[model samples]
Target: MPPSADPSVSVTLAEIARIAGVGRAAVSNWRRRHDSFPAPVGGTDTSPQFALSQVEEWLRRQGKLDEVGGRERLWPEFEALGDRDAMGMAIAVTGARLGTAEAGHAGHAAGLLSETAPARLGTADAAVGIPVGISLSDAQRALVERAVSLARKQGAYETFDFLLGRWLDTHVRQIGVTPPPLADLMAEVAELSRDGEAGDVGTVLDPACGTGGLLLAAARRWAGSGSARTPLKILGQDIDPTQAALAAMRILLAGHLPERGDASWEVDVQAGNTLRADPHPGIRADVVLCNPPFNERDWGYEELATDTRWTYGLPPRTESELAWIQHALSRLSPGGTAVLLLPPGVASRRAGRRIRAALLRAGVLRAVVALPPGAAPPHSVALHLWVLRAPSGDGTELGRPVLLIDAADVRTEPSGGTQKTGRAAIDWPLLRKIVVSAVQTGGNGGNLPVGHVSVPLIELLDDEVDLTPARHVPKTTISTDLSLRRSWTRFGTLLHELRDLTATLSALELSTEEPAGQGTVTVGDLVRAGALTLRAGQQPADGAVRTGDAPTDSVPVLTVSDVLAGCGPSSWLPAYEVSAGEAAGTLTVTVPEEVVVVGAYRAFGAWVDTDAPTVLGPQLFVLRVDPTLLDPWFLAGCLRAPANARRAGTHTSTSSRIDVRRLQVLQVSLEEQRRYGETFRQLTAFERSLREAGAVGRELVDGLTNGLSAGRLPRDRR
Candidate 1:
């Protein structure tokens, strides 16, 4: 073991693969083929853990350590600490050191080594506001030094941001991050509401800040509006102490960014439950932006029933989001704006109706924008943004109108010839433009966007007082004549395609008599003989898979749903290919031509993928067959046969899952295999054509019914 190695630290196989910049399969292969491989120290046989010291020594001797990045090398050590809070503290310490060095405070480094270092580190400690009673170990201190060195090489801000992003990725389920697009949109909307203000934004607050994503976005917006030199004050509070500390470090570092100008910042972040304890009781900010936790029951409802913040009304126990809204309203100065991302239920839930009515009555609610799904956290639901303005304590604003805009249909079409999923990628740029325009124009009738409407406060103060934008926005009408003609044209094209497919299917010939019995082999046999290689798709870490349209750096992933449906990839994952002697951990296996992808659950099916370089998703099996030994299409067809499906299925009450190794395929000559493969391919095409025709047939019927009822088409049709 190396002198610095901690014998107590052990790493899982996945971590070892990440450390060596290889796949998990490669690590397993190493264990099987190499005699010098380290033995498992602990954990179950399926997921054995190896001592970090031994693994490090082995990698060093194998020359794999040469290409590993400094951050990747330190990650295992941090994970071995077995405490997320300590990992966060170590990150905070590293950020403090970087900030100190960047500001030319070399003397403070010595102070950090002393017993009173938290107090003597000066601005570094003041900036981060390190938590009390938490001290670093000797091993942790050494890790911090290495992190500081890395920051020096690759710009302090960049290195810190990378580390923070990775940390967020690891604990994605526990932390809810505001998606960048939504964050930017919220900032833009706030800016639009405050248009023509005399100077820069004075102060901004986020009660449930959650690492200060909203506040940071607000700062960027202010800087982009050419107010970079203006002084800004940011306040935040979170229940997690580590998050509060890290948020402080992020804001402090943002202030020093060269492109953001020399804006002096007064950042005050505290660790406590914001709803229970009001930290900034007396200060009113110019802007308040928040994306608070949803549906929380125990948000000090019992104890704080009479808390002065509930000016709108007493929020019910089930309406924690409403309480957050009122809390945001209380933090704003008169005429100041507060933009909050809230669940759609708060707009119309029975428990929140009273509070919603009170807000509309006060003329405080400015606009309600309905965003597309996948725009933010809880990506499956379409969330709403309530833009509220603290009334200036005047009766003149009592009868103001509220703008309602529904941009839920604003999304990008999937790219790279991939099939669409239930969720679509939000077109942030278009959404921003539609929303900003609607808010700026107050959604007046003239030339307003399709889903924009301006409703009077009196009109909205009905019995329910539902604030859902979709309910109020008028549905767009289609031209009867034009739609009828377009439907007819599409119907004709689909009929012609269907006819050709039917003719092709009819041309194929088959033998009437039963053929001689053929030899068969199991998939496991073929894999063992080197004629096929089976690879299981890995379940990506939470927040790692990108749904909808693929980004430039991402690749389409072939999911089990895609395999079962006989379609293309429905989602994407980041590509971590080795580039320029650097590896971004292990490279995900990209399916090549002739690869057979099989669905492992719900049903037994197979797809022969001709598209190369598609990443495989979880709950699927990729079978790469040797062309000399097996035909890919023939193998896929046999595996998908009903008899084989029944034999391989593991039956349960809900659904059937396939054991891919148990699937059987016929053994035949290559020429015979090619003949059957061609027929199978033709049948697949016919099935797709039938589905298309069915969809078009429905459209045709609907169009005819509407046209005849509306007198747009003559009933005689002579």
Candidate 2:
């Protein structure tokens, strides 16, 4: 229990449950049973909130304060800031103060200042003041000090990362955090610029630098081989001063943008609206990276309509993304490159077609890469990355074909138990390699991987310069004869397997008498008795850079989809390693003998017997059983029963959520459990065989029909 400072801040019941290390139901029980519990301070009747100070007092009296961390304790004050925007500003202010304090400790005067911050600090230098008009109370200021101390104890980079993540988590709806994979991909793709290859990307700029993630990524890329020759100059601007300050702090802490006194580093980060106010007007950079606000309806359309930056054409109000594209283009030095993350709609939006056509004809639009959904925030919508380079005076690479990469099918790490948070994990390193290779090869469409293609400039410069990668990229088409042959072979094998499984299923007999019931227990009970353990899988918090040091691409992640479909491993792999000293909640499976349950979907459980080491993905739960007391297969079979699923499930129109702890299990002797396990296994084999046969039968029909229609296989003329 840290000292209670603010009683004004309030928290939701869910947050209270999270802090207490108990289920939400437990918190509800407390409020209902205890008359002295804090009354509802805010929120609806369905989800009442409580004052943080009162809740802390209550928890302390109940001896539950020890369960919450100091970081967790600070969340109520943030939430108490009243609105999402205010919370964001508060976070930024705290981050700036933290940066300044770190700098002061290092004995520097200017010490990492954001343009938004007050030029001079008062005696209480560590105190953070939000620019969003909400002043922090004395108690709140003390809370910030404690957070800074914790952050300082951890490395500066680590502390900023933690704070940034928590901030994003607190306000995920109002803002978006670019997943590390996508950010890295953008940085790598930007690095394909001529200057980048020559190891002389001297300047980097991000107009819409959200927490400075893209800029930091660029900084890492520019510092080639960890010994970059050119001293990098970085510039960034954001609409929110708080976020801008946080971004400045993050970059400064990473040491990419050193303090003002440092000789090699030159950094200028301003807090103002990028679209409305040109913070770095007329400044050209070697490389530009931006993930601008998407579908901005009020992006100074009328005012900027005649601005000189609109070289292609006056962008329609509906096409603010195009405005950003042109803005990046205008900021580029001749032959300099810029990579911008845009929505898929921008490529073919009717309003932006003219601008797209113009850019394509001018040879400034180099490539369009389609990324899978969950590549970044707004996870459901697939996004596109446009790589552009300013035309040289001689126009050497102008007429070259544009590269189109359809990487929407790139693999992602499996969510251990559930698909809970963050974007769908991507094989970032592999995707980066694929995008870079395609760009360098002049979009040749030569020996390119499965989902990439290179199309001629003339082809793309048609009536509408539609640059949708999937539309241009060639789809793999096989000869009808070959398709039929493969389908027939697969069908034949499945039929044979089905026959054997049918016989085996028929031969297995159930005992006429029921085994004596040993007892009944809940999942929590078993866990308490040390007969089983429950573990949830890991996911990187919003904007997190790998849970630990392990690279996200190398680790295998078992996702909920894999468990439901009984597939091997999902394509997603976390950048972090399972064996690394990872932060808690980092999803990795170190144990094999466990039942992986899909807590959010239809399928509830499966016994994972695979040999590959895998991390558990989100929305998943793993139950590890003690072999001496319980049969793993039997427990899995019991959990899979429809009755158990029905009991645990809280169904809705679109999906269902299961609370595994509430599901009941029939306890029996280990030998009896084995008998049931064998029976269940045989039945499961029968079900799988039927499914395989059905799938193969459908494929066989489709292939035969297609083959006959295409005249690739002979058809009887009877």
Candidate 3:
């Protein structure tokens, strides 16, 4: 016996059994078979215990463990294993359950256990289509059927392993991924099956079987060893070849095919569009579950204007939503049931009104369930699940209740990127509880199966059947005004800061003064005095001029307005940056309001000097004026402040920046311009400093604070 397996050193058989969730008999059987299993050091023979590791090791070496990649695949086998059954019995039980489900219900339950098909499903075309009448090789068919049957037979334990193998074989990548885990699918299926109508399961079908996600769930519910009707003969198809392959693998796991072995399920997967081709052609099933893509265009409308799928009415060229709805209807056998996903807009959008009306008049619109947004995404718009039936063929119909379910009321934001899986991106336990309850209680436009209030049909019709969840998730007493709350916090902080800043400002007597006062010196005069150097001419680098490499620094690259008036931030500032590698001798214009100016010369903006930094095309010039006499910000603001910006542009040369000579003529009162300009200049300067300082300083301080808290850094300061 291995040292780790010495019973006294580790957990005993009783503890191990409890931990592994198995009974004493199962633990006893393991010790008898494996010689390496250890007995307790001092315990008596009759009360002797074995190490837990012994059983764990034996299970691993014996290959009792599975490598199924997903929870859905492993669930069936897990459930069966927990029941203390052998592999063959587990497979049989699971298959029997799936096969025994009410007609179309198997498809949905099966889908839960399998992968899903493409969101945009249809009769295969060239995008994925091969010639129609073409059939699969006999061997392929057998392989596919066997996979289907095995998938049907697989209990919770083997489901993961089977699904992993199937997923790899199928080459699937999830898009528009769903929420809620696989466990929820099983629970929901079980919940639904419990409400079964005595003995009336007709046939089963999934129009859109991505990987038979829903079908497997339904299959497990009905096919398991129970007091139910015969196992449902499974049928599934997908437009995507890969999805078809996956579906086949799931079915094979369920023990579906005969004699042919590995070649079983290939016949189940046809390579054609389900929508346009309808490969099943004339077949009908008792139940249809589909998660068809929403609002897609390009379904070859022009070619099939008079197609039979348009039974309700002509589908608008722009609306694929209506076409899919009608298509699902056309395939359902009379008295069959179907539950499908749809964008909530389909129920209320004007473009789909005619189709909605037709479905309504036909009485096939069984219920409109309003689900939480992101039920399936790309959009957070509330979605709807349409529960439908083809008015029971033999007059066995019940009430015409819509069962409009508004499940959005129960959701919370995800934290740490941990999204809830399936339908609504909410917690599974909660989602399962709500979904099962809704299914059972039939609340909010549902027939109460148990303990929940039922909304009347008249109530649904009241507000144009607005199946939005907000209308239903009853209002609570605590109404939180998120926006208002934020505003209050902001105002409180602002008020506190204002009081502190007022005290500080009172201490500094910063005076605004004209450099030359009422006896002012001109910007041109200052530039000429050699206090400032103009940016020299430079061509754009021969190759592509990346925005990052464009220059700045040495010469204050002033735009046209800066040359004419001054500078500041403005729309026409040249955003493409260049290094100040070499100081240019000419005035350089730039997009930045203070650093450079845009010439509103021709029509919009411009600069004057030809030798300065200029726009590549036309209507711009850079003026690198000395910042000695006039502040860059003050000058720029004076020039571009709406009225002044327009005024500066009026003095422009044709097809170029505003003429510096014409601008120089316009007298800007050193007193008035500086009066407002100084305060603006200080604010702009302070703002720039704040931005340049950025969060790095604050982050460093935060790190120091954290380090001090952790006793790594001292908090002492002078």
Top candidate, metric TM-score: 1
* CA lDDT for candidate 2: 0.68
Best by lDDT: 1
lDDT of residue 665 for candidate 3: 17
Task: Report every candidate's CA lDDT.
Answer: 0.72, 0.68, 0.44
Candidate 2 C-alpha lDDT tens digits along 147-218: 666665545556556667767754555567777777877877777656445466777889998788888777
Q: Count the backbone clashes (under 3 Å) in each candidate.
A: 0, 24, 143
Which should have the higher lDDT, number 1 or number 3?
1
Alpha-carbon runs more than 4 Å astray in model 3: 1-177, 180-202, 225-229, 254-267, 300-311, 394-401, 418-425, 444-718
TM-score for candidate 1, residues paired by index: 0.76
Clash pairs detected, candidate 1: none
- Compose the digit string of candidate 3's lDDT tens values, residues 619-668: 34345444444445455554444444444454444553443322331235
lDDT: the better of candidates 1 and 2: 1
